[model samples]
Target: MRMIVMIIFLVLLGLLAILNRHFLTYPHTLNLGFAEYKDMPVGLMLLAASLIPMLVFYFWASVTKLRAQADTAKLLRDMESLRTSLDSQEGSRFQQLQAHLDRQFAEMQTQALPSSGSASEVASLAAKMDAMKRDLDLQLDQMDDYLKRKLG
Candidate 1:
């Protein structure tokens, strides 16, 4: 949109200059505190003065946009690295929890087997634990998927 506006402005300026060619070319004297100029095309000088700033601003805007893009790219890369680190940490924690649960199940099986009533109770508890673990795993998977979708 800015580019289109700039183009339109340039076209209009060109048309104006073309329409007033004789006036733009007409020479006049210019005076400054320190120096004086003779036979200067003041209209053309004014036109060039206006154009120089516009050109400078356009290039400055372009450079600023490029810098912003580079910064964004760097931030994205940092985020990706952080996500990867967190995923590895989560995986290690999951493995540790599984190991702890397995050890506890083993201890429970050995101690509960000696009594018949407690054996049945242990089986029921094991079933419940398995169901809970499955639910927890499903929830974690859903959360990971949600995070991936949002970030990517």
Candidate 2:
């Protein structure tokens, strides 16, 4: 695509140069500076026209390169933000898992101990522990859903 555009631009430049030469040779009713100089050769006009377009193209090329650099910088910034968010979420998930495991271990210890009081108290504690574990699992699942949504 770039090559095709370049070819088209070169053809246009060639045409402009030809037109400049023809105009320079012809008598100018409304002569702009160089047009009044009949003694001056037609080649100079053609050269000036051709060089002007090339200079303009050079400036435009530089502008496009700078814009591309800016775009690259913005992409890098966005990537960095994503990476930071991922790292933070991972840390939070690890802490949550650790806390859940610790709570489960504590519950197991309570279950391991000998029953000293009435059966009702022990059964109540066990039931509450089970409910707490279930709630924690639900919370973890919700966290997973939130993370998936954030990533997508």
Candidate 3:
């Protein structure tokens, strides 16, 4: 839409220039040695035309730079908050893990203890194993003697 407006303005300017071509072609004769004060020179008009665009562009760039700096500062604050939160969460997790390890260590200590009268129980278990071994030896001897007699 802005391009359309600029195109229309340029077309009107061109038409006006064409219509005033005869007037622009006629040169004016000026009298010499006339004191002309407060007159604008052609160079000043050209300088104004050139410098206005540059000034506008400079102002635009500065405004955009300021906006970008503000955005960067806001993001940095957000990042700092996020970093602090993460550090706190990690610290809590480490503490939780340490507590869990301690609990597991305490549980392992409970499991390591055997029943009461452990030495007496071990002696009784050894006597039972010896009795079973003697019964197995007697059975093997009876089987050997029975087999030898049957073969004879």
Candidate 4:
């Protein structure tokens, strides 16, 4: 879009210059504080002055756009790295929790097999596991919400 606009502006400026060729080429005097320029094509000089700034601005905008794209790409790479690290950490934590739960169940089975209250003990353990599951799910949901908020 910017390119199109720039091209149109250049074409219009070219047409105007072409239509006013005689005026643009006509000689005149230019004065500065310390020097004077005689027989100068003042119109052409003004045209060059206008074009220089426009060209500088166009290049500046292109460089700024490229910098912005590079920054966005860097941000996405950082986000992806962070997400992968978080996933790995979560996986390790889950593995640790599973190991702990397995150990606890093994201990419970060994102790309960010789007791009469084994059924009640199993039910209590099941309830505790269910509670832990709910807590884990809540934590996961909170983490998900946090990630969504950050990304958005």
Each candidate structure's TM-score, on Cα atoms with residue i matched to residue i, is 0.74, 0.48, 0.45, 0.63
Better of 1 and 3 by lDDT: 1
Model 4 C-alpha RMSD to native? 4.8
C-alpha lDDT of all candidate models, in order:
0.91, 0.70, 0.61, 0.89
lDDT of 3 by residue, 1-152 (tens): 44465567557756765786655444444334685434334343443465577557667877888899999879777766775676579668856875885676556545544755654555565566558657866885686576446433
What CA root-mean-square deviation does each model show from the true structure?
A: 3.1, 7.5, 28.5, 4.8
- The number of the candidate with the highest lDDT is 1
lDDT of 2 by residue, 1-152 (tens): 55477778878977876777665565434457765554555565556677787768877987898899999879777866886687689769977876886787677657756665635566676678679868977886787677556644
Off-target runs (Cα >4 Å) in candidate 1 are 29-40, 114-124
Question: What 10-residue stretch in candidate 4 is worst by lDDT?
Answer: 143-152
Which candidate tops TM-score?
1
Which scores greater on lDDT, model 2 or model 4? 4
- The whole-model C-alpha lDDT of candidate 4 against the native structure comes to 0.89
- Model 1 over residues 14-83: C-alpha lDDT tens digits? 9999999899989999898799999999999999999999899888988999999999889888887898
Per candidate, the number of residue pairs that clash is 0, 0, 0, 0
Structure candidate 1, residue pairs in collision: none
lDDT of 3 at 99: 82
Model 4, range 84-120, lDDT digits (tens) per residue?
7998898899889989988988888787877769967
